[model samples]
Target: MVDTSDLLPKTPRYLKVPLIILNTILWLLGIVLVACGGYALSKLSHLDDIINVSLPAGIIVIGVFFLVLTVVGCVVAYKEKLVGLVFYTVFMLILLVCLIGVGGGAFSYRNDAAKPIGTAWDKATNDERNIAQEFFDCCCWTDANSTCGSNCQVVNETGSVVPNLNKTTCNITVVDYVQKNLYVAGAAGVTVGVIEFISMLFALFLIVRICKNPRPKSYD
Candidate 1:
């Protein structure tokens, strides 16, 4: 019977420790992303009318993928499995492509962002309207109607505001809010891509190193 242990690739000491450290970073990053995505989805889902669910959902997807990569990387490093290392490198490439696609697509979407945002105003629930109004210190979408949300208020009595304090409309408020957050997401995606790219290089190096110098079988 053949011993399977000998088939594992030998991880050189120089790269081995660094690879483990990189995988640990991936693990922490995955946790942060998953948490952030989940929080955004749960706490801010009501604003979906103005912002798409795909944003948070995409974050969760990338976070989970990173988690998987962390496991794969750890295993390959510990077991010195060449096959697993190759797969790790492949997964890293796929992740990098996805990051570029998502980041690029999101930035493109931002270029014409106002169109959908303008349309979404009408579809917002009253609760969402109130939330946006309060946060942006606005009244109505048009602020033309005499009626207003919580954000608009008369001063006290004597020196009271003529109608309400906020002069801007919710329409303007929501648009600005969404655009800023979108920029943040795009930047974060780029950062993740950079990290994945570096990890990919490390994996490739480990693969070549293993191929050139396979670990010798143990003598009993």
Candidate 2:
């Protein structure tokens, strides 16, 4: 029989250790991303009407994708499976593309968030306004003196109207809050994308090394 053993790639000792360590770190990062997504969703759930529900949902999806990718990466790195490494690399590339797209969308949305926020404020019923006011700790959607019905009350503990409290309207405050959050999300996407790019490069380097010298060695 032809010796197939010689065709197998021998994994270097140095490469094995770093691969395991890096993959483990990646796995933990994936868990952290998932938790971040869950937290974001929980926070956004309170403002269901005013915020875009899809954004939090998308974060959750991305987190889950990273989790899956991490698991696959660990398995491939442990087994030193060349095909699995290639698949992992390709998946990472796809994920990097997705992250870039998400980042761009978030950054672009920051500029466009004001209009939607205004519309939501305009369409807000009394209950919705109260919810927003109570959550944001603000008085009215616009100026404090502007008509906001019963929800625009800026009262102190003694039921006395708190002067100048209404000056800080939810329109400005909420819009600023949303824009800040979008910027944060965009930054996070870019950061994760860079990490994914690095991971792909590592995988490709291993793939090339394995192709050069096909030998098999057990890491366990």
Candidate 3:
């Protein structure tokens, strides 16, 4: 009888070719995600309006930092080098931070930002409120409204009369500035969320592919 052992096929000495291909794709995706985040961060400074909060600063710093690391990681991956572990670890952590900031900023802005503006609107006379409401309706939550939600209503006192547009109390520029900043914040929050999701997916793919590949039999 023929020797059965000699008839069996040898197992691959390294990762399967398909898994290596998938890992390479994942590494490329990670590079794209990180690069997009960097572009968003760099463009932030040029935007017409931005909230001067730690959030934007953090985004800019972290985003750029990850971008550099990801680019290096891509070069390493192309060599079929085992750098996915490092890339996935760093990216996963970065995604967590981004998710937190995005969720917090969006929730807080919707609640907290409206409070002062709404209160001011409510304290103003109907005419003033109407004007302020118009501003809010047109500006404060324009992005949200586009998605079918009601815009922020300026808070106005029920019986107060509209204040005169005297030079002392009226500053339309200030209101306009606030509106622009709010819009910027909302857009940034949404963008951060999207980037975070993409980052997360790439991280997962890299980690999964890394895990699937065992050490070569030669190493054993």
Model 3 earns a TM-score of 0.41
Q: Encode model 2's per-residue lDDT on 32-132: one tens digit a residue.
A: 76787788788768777877767667777887888888788878866768899999888888888888987899899899898988787777676777777
The CA lDDT at 38 in model 1 is 88
Model 1: per-residue Cα lDDT over 1-220, one tens digit each: 8786544345465676677788888789888878878887876676777567788788889889999888889888766788998988888888889888878877887777778876676676657667766666777666455335444546666885534634777667766766776676778789878877777777777777778888777711
Off by over 4 Å in 3: 1-52, 114-176, 214-220
Kindly give the stretch of ten consecutive residues in candidate 1 with the minimal lDDT sum: 143-152
Off by over 4 Å in 1: 1-11, 125-137, 143-167
Candidate that would win on TM-score:
2
Q: What is the Cα-based lDDT of residue 19 in candidate 2?
A: 60
What lDDT is obtained when candidate 2 is compared to the true structure?
0.74
Question: Which TM-score value belongs to model 1?
Answer: 0.77
The positional error of residue 136 in candidate 3, measured at the CA in angstroms, is: 17
Model 3 lDDT per residue over 46-110, tens place: 32132223444555455555455555544444443456545554664665576566546645664
Report the backbone clash tally of model 2. 5
TM of each candidate vs. truth:
0.77, 0.79, 0.41
Candidate 2: 10-residue stretch with minimal lDDT: 6-15
